[model samples]
Target: MTAGNRCRRNVLALTVPIVAVVVVVFGFALDRWVIDSGIEIAPEPAALFPSAPIMDPARQSDLDGAHFDALFAQGIAGLRAGKPGQAAAAFEAARRLGPKVPALYVNLGFARLALGQVDAAVESFETSINLRPAQANAYFGLAEAREQQGDMEAALGAMRTFVHLASEDDRFRRRALSAIWEWEAALGRRPSNGTDAAQTETNEYAQAKGSDLLTAELGRLDGGSGTLAHFRGKTLVLNVWATWCAPCRVELPSLQRLSEKLNPEQYAVVGLSTDEDPDFVREFLREVGVAYPNYLDPGRDVAFGILKIESYPQTLLIRPDGSIAQRIVGARAWDEPEMVANIESVR
Candidate 1:
């Protein structure tokens, strides 16, 4: 070959590989940017619990039979698909097949609620609670139905019962607590000293004398690390949430708006996702348009162990000294003027 041709060939070979590398790198970068920018990732079959309560097999042996089981399964499927009418029919059938099962009534109540039949829903929930007085989920359903009927006093009463009966680690505990606060506020009365006196007293917020928050480190979504100590000098509004929690999703936008309204120099809004899958957490954050810094708590070390937080969307306002100033148990309109002022008062 001629020397000029040989030189041209060598240059072409080197240039071709360099160009290919650049193209590949750019493609990957773009893909990442799209993902981070809230492009919906095909989520894993969502690890979701049915809103329709399930039959407790331990209590009702009749429900263990195939006929009742089949009807119950159909009811749950209908509820999940948003076919409340179908769900109610199925749950009613299940109840007929196993009249002793309180959960059947609870499921029926949820279906009724979905259909906006508040009175029927209330009856169903009341029946469930009467059949099994300690049924926690029934109380939750009853509380919701009462609220729908504009009975704040009854709603608060049922909610308090749910909070009292539910286990300390129940996921619904915090949301129920938040609901109690709203119901009390609406009625222009403080929570009455009753069976849930301690919870009522601390309904608005919980105080922790000392916390080990600063010692914990978590993995950030952008392939980095974060710790509570990083915002040592600023008031930290730390939120613990999960992808599957409905109340958490409802509250996230407000938290984002709150973050925007507050001065970043004086405050920091951080989210800790308790989802086991980091990919799901990232996709959820993107889908929700949450721009605040988020970290993963795959093992729930910080949420359950350090913070002793059991409910989803539990937010803590940490004072500059690393002590927890307030623990908000449920979702709220964080961007509202009053909420903003309350947060500012903490600072």
Candidate 2:
């Protein structure tokens, strides 16, 4: 070979490895960013009871007719208005009228917890459980109240019962299991065989059976309006988050990076903010530098009423055909190769 050609070939060989090394180092840094984002594994707040007024025929027969119904309606209204004190009073009156109804006591307990009456909340939950031993929601309320009171043992016990009594397909079952694992670790006890085994083998992404996406028009954080249908014909990583949730904040950067990396034609990462204040949500999105398409569900019509999502920072991977492909609870390293591969699998 000519001397000039040999010199050029050596230079090309040296430059290729240098460029490869830089690319490898950059990839490692990105992976570490995803891992070190402080994604928390703590359990989210349990969904409150009596999402609406409780007026079942069986329960109404036990009450003083319209009097109990009026009180129950008042309590539900109070809960919706964020007036837990008012809700507690109304529910207490309803409880007096229909002491035999377990749901009344459960709703009363939910309101009491909101008012920081932890001891009373425990009593109320226990009463509901006693009246109806299979009341899964009562156990969930008791677990949350006990945890708030710094009683990990009682919390763990209540949560375990909740997991056992709850349906296998119950959305809260997995969250409760995650809590059980955390509590066991906190108490320095080995996780029970069932829970530990499940945790170890748990896939980060759970295949969802049905479509839960809502087509309700939601206000965009930036401006104007949009509906979930706007993203039709694309694989969506729908992240349900709230501004106050620490884990949600921690994982947002990774989610933003993932949104940037994915092909916009095939995959879309969208955020649904459950925050009630649009201004606050807009400010938070700006602070976090999240550029993904996000919409606000201020009244939670979609998050709670339609989707029945009980926790914050929950992510749903939706297929192009609109079927829910996966339900991922808790914060995750979305930019990681494993997560990217999982998203790719569905696409």
Candidate 3:
């Protein structure tokens, strides 16, 4: 999907408005339309300031598009009415329905920004980028979040990417360029390895795929037999976990939610538990209402021996053709937009 961006102005363009918005999602109303995606940005070294303005390049393609959802509209309405809390909730509810629009996360970021939730705003913007890396406006919001965290290099790099990807005719292109220039002057370079932020983002979570293994028979929690071969035609989200691992327990519900959100015909999320006690696993699943098919490996042969998995709560993304695509070694918000889209994007 082609991503779109919308921002009434840049962060440093107006000191009063930008600061107000970041502190509180901006004004109760800015002129006529809602400053739907405003953030508090400070240009000075003392604070995280907005550099310049970058307007929305694809206004029509946002939540108001042809495939509109009521929740998405409600979120926009909340933003427009100066009620960011309501706006944030609406956006998340809309996310559960799995709307693929990148702007959705953009608006959610603004709402979080207004609430003074800098970390969450950063997550939303990054997720938007994950959905569509070319979405120029997401960079605008991200620059602010990175600045707030005192990551000047990352912030500068995000603006640079925005400028590179944004169309020349984009009304706010000049303003964004101005921000970049100011950031570079202040930092004394084009972001001393700022691009590494994006690189490390992927590097931390993404692992290289390897060859398919044993395809061996395994014990199902229901007493029937199973194997990786049964899911050959679908992308398998193989989560290696155990009932005893606390992080695994924390990650399972969201993984189950991820399983539910994905198209069952094309994707399957299965649990590979290494618990010696099948009844304990059964009790854990039943207690959590986890209905996904799970296979047991008491001896750890299939896990440690075959997959070479050395950690608990590990996840592997298996392609439909029986090859591994990606692996994650820790807990994650499996149901988040980035993770869901990552799963669906598997070839």
Best by TM-score: 2
Q: Model 2, 80-196: lDDT tens per residue?
A: 899999999999888788777677788899999999999999999999998767677789899999999999999998988776555445678788888888888888786555458
Give candidate 3's error at residue 347 in angstroms. Answer: 0.9
Residue 101 alpha-carbon offset, candidate 3, angstroms: 51
TM-score of decoy 2: 0.42
Which ranges of candidate 1 are over 4 A from the true structure? Answer: 1-211
CA lDDT for candidate 2 = 0.82
- Candidate 3 ranges beyond 4 A from true positions: 1-214
Q: How close to the true structure is residue 21 of candidate 2, measured as C-alpha lDDT?
A: 99
Clash pairs, model 1 backbone: none
lDDT tens string, model 1, 1-347? 99999999999889989999999999899987755766577767865568888666675444446788899999999999999999999998888778867778999999999999999999999998887676778999999999999988889989888876665557888899779877776776654554444364444322231235765768678656677677888888999998778899999999999999999999989999876556668888888899998898755656875788978789999888888899999988899999888888776
Q: Model 2 off-target regions past 4 Å?
A: 1-214
Q: Candidate 3's residue-wise lDDT over 83-181, tens digit each?
A: 999999999888766556677899899899888899999999999998766567789889878878889889888876766554334566567666666
